[model samples]
Target: MFRFAMLTLVAAVSAVGAAQAVVALDPVRGATALAAVWREGAPPPQVQDRAAILKSADGHYWAEGEIQGRPVRFLVDTGATTVALTQEDARRLGYDTEALVYGQKVLTAAGEARAAVVKLPAVSIAGASVSDVDAMIVEKGLETSLLGMSYLGRLSGFEATRTSLVLQP
Candidate 1:
């Protein structure tokens, strides 16, 4: 009688194991069942693609970016139409300040100034990057390089809080 009871228990266990094996073989059905169980719990956390720039002590958003693989510091300026590079920064990026044609006249905080339009092969800040970006080399009156609309406009979105500028690429 004991041997018969042991055989019955073994058969029951084998049947349960076979049932689980069958369920595991069908991935779509297993996923559907998992989704149903998951619905009862809190939703999974979403993945966010974003970068942030903290406000500087000078009360402006500043970012460390790269141009032609060289590091550059930029002042985030939404007011500017295109990225504005100072003569020093342009030189640092290997641009010959003397050769660039400064025919475009632009109004600056100091006064009117001449600028030379140039196309950057690539520019990247944090994780956001852009190719063939329109930029200008300010002949004068630009204290720092400006990260302007030309780069920001390509992003999915951006927002400014009192403490930081959040970039969504």
Candidate 2:
């Protein structure tokens, strides 16, 4: 009876230990966390050491920051009439692009497609604050999104000085 009880206790302890394994999510270290899981030998993400944050000489602007603790690279594009993101980036932001109200037909490099318009409550760039910024969450196979005039135009002044874009809001 004593041996039987000890065996049962060992089994229960082993089961509990197996259940407590903790899996870690490293945004910088997990490069293909989105792209692959089943595939073999995906590269590990190297955390970026931003030397200088990006700002544009053009009117549009964005600051590199964490979205759900992941690295994001943004560009200021005044040429783009509206704020836009590729479909994949939107998904990373926890947005289902297909379900959002796609309010416009945009002329993209590929072709015309439905684009969902969204307003970001707060977007800060280089210690500057801009609120209620009109933005878009794009859907799949995206090159990149342009932080465009729709958001930048609302700023007090967006100008190109010598080396940097001056954004006054």
* TM-scores vs. true structure, each candidate: 0.69, 0.54
lDDT by residue (tens digit), candidate 1, 9-127: 23432443211110001223431110000001111122257777775554445678889988877766554457888899899999999999986766555556778889999888777
Q: Pick the candidate with the highest lDDT.
A: 1
Best by TM-score: 1
Any idea what lDDT model 2 has? 0.45
Q: What is candidate 1's local distance difference test score?
A: 0.62
Error of 1 at 91 (Å): 0.7
Q: How far is 106's C-alpha from truth in model 1 (Å)?
A: 1.3
TM-score of 1: 0.69
lDDT score of residue 104 within candidate 1: 71
Clashing pairs in model 1? Answer: none
Error of 1 at 66 (Å): 0.8
Q: Give all candidates' CA lDDT scores.
A: 0.62, 0.45
Which residue pairs in candidate 2 collide?
87-138, 87-139, 87-140
